[model samples]
Target: MLIEQILKTKGGDVTIIKADHTLAEAARILDEARIGAVVAMNGDQLAGVLSERDILRQVARHGAYALQMTVENSMTRGVITATPQETIDQCLGRMTDRRIRHLPVLRDGRLAGIISIGDLVKWKIEEHKAEADAMAEYIKGG
Candidate 1:
């Protein structure tokens, strides 16, 4: 399956935050959105990504005061991106190698959507089940 198909099912809504937004604000957005990460934007440009792991790391190093720092301070820079044309299995390999859970999907050099490891795993499992069911039906018919 292609990344585009996953996005079609997951929808194209990306929860974005400004680079200047405080960790406190970022936390609120994460909690309210019930998402693990958000794309950090700088005047319509992709800055980086802020994840629960990023927030926890900052808090571990700087204490509660880290909450006052900007998202740019804690966000992971040089983010690895995925194109709509990428295959699900191929993405799984890259994500595993990089130890990243989130990937920003780009189309035409612009942010299109964001996908998480959970999403890929879920879809992969579904694909496997569908394939197995098809094979079983073929056997029964034969």
Candidate 2:
């Protein structure tokens, strides 16, 4: 399935945080939203992404001081993004290769939505089930 189709089902609402925002603020947003990552923005431009892992790493390295750091300092820059036209399998491969769990989806060079490794895995399982059902029905001559 295409990334666009997934977005259509999931809706393209991405939680964003400013680059200048503190990591503590980003953590609050993530906690309140029950999400794994947030897109860091710089005046409407995509700056990078900040995830739970990034925050945890910072905390491990600098203790409580990490929370005071700017989102830009904790975020993963030069992010590897996915296009709406890409297939789930393609995106999954890229994520696996990069060892990333989240991918920001872009449309026309603008942030559209985000996809998680869990989402792709769920769809893959659903697709397999659908195919198995179809084959079973075919065998039953229905």
Candidate 3:
């Protein structure tokens, strides 16, 4: 299935934060939203992406002081993005190659939605189960 299909099932709401926001604030947003990452936006422009991994990396290097730092400092600038038309396999490949857990979907030069590795894996498992069930039915029918 394509990314658009996934978005349709997963909902198109995207969690975003400003570049100037502090890591502490970002952490709170992530925790409260129960999301893995937040898109950093500078007005209508996409600036970067701040993920839980990025926050952890900063904490490892800078301790508690990292929380006081700006999200822009820890965010992955020039983030890799995906289009709605892209296939799940293609997106999975990109995520694996980049060692990233999240990918923001862009359409018409605007942020559309975000997809996580969890979402891809869930879809794959469901597809597999459906195929297995179909095979069983076919065997019984024959």
Best by TM-score: 1
TM value for model 2: 0.97
lDDT of each: 0.95, 0.95, 0.95
Query: For candidate 3, which ten residues in a row score worst on lDDT?
Result: 7-16
- Estimated TM-score per prediction? 0.98, 0.97, 0.97
lDDT of 2 by residue, 1-142 (tens): 9999999999899999999999999999999999999999888788999999999999999999999999999899999999999999999999999999999999999999999999999999999999999999999996
The TM-score measured for candidate 1 stands at: 0.98
At residue 17, give the lDDT of candidate 2: 94
Kindly list the per-residue Cα lDDT of model 3 for residues 74-121, writing each as its tens digit: 999989999999999999999999999999999998999999999999
- Writing each residue's lDDT as its tens digit, candidate 1 over 1-142 gives 9999999989889999999999999999999999999999987788999999999999999999999999999999999999999999989999999999999999997999999999999999999999999999999999
The count of residue-pair clashes in candidate 2 stands at 0
Clashes of each: 0, 0, 0
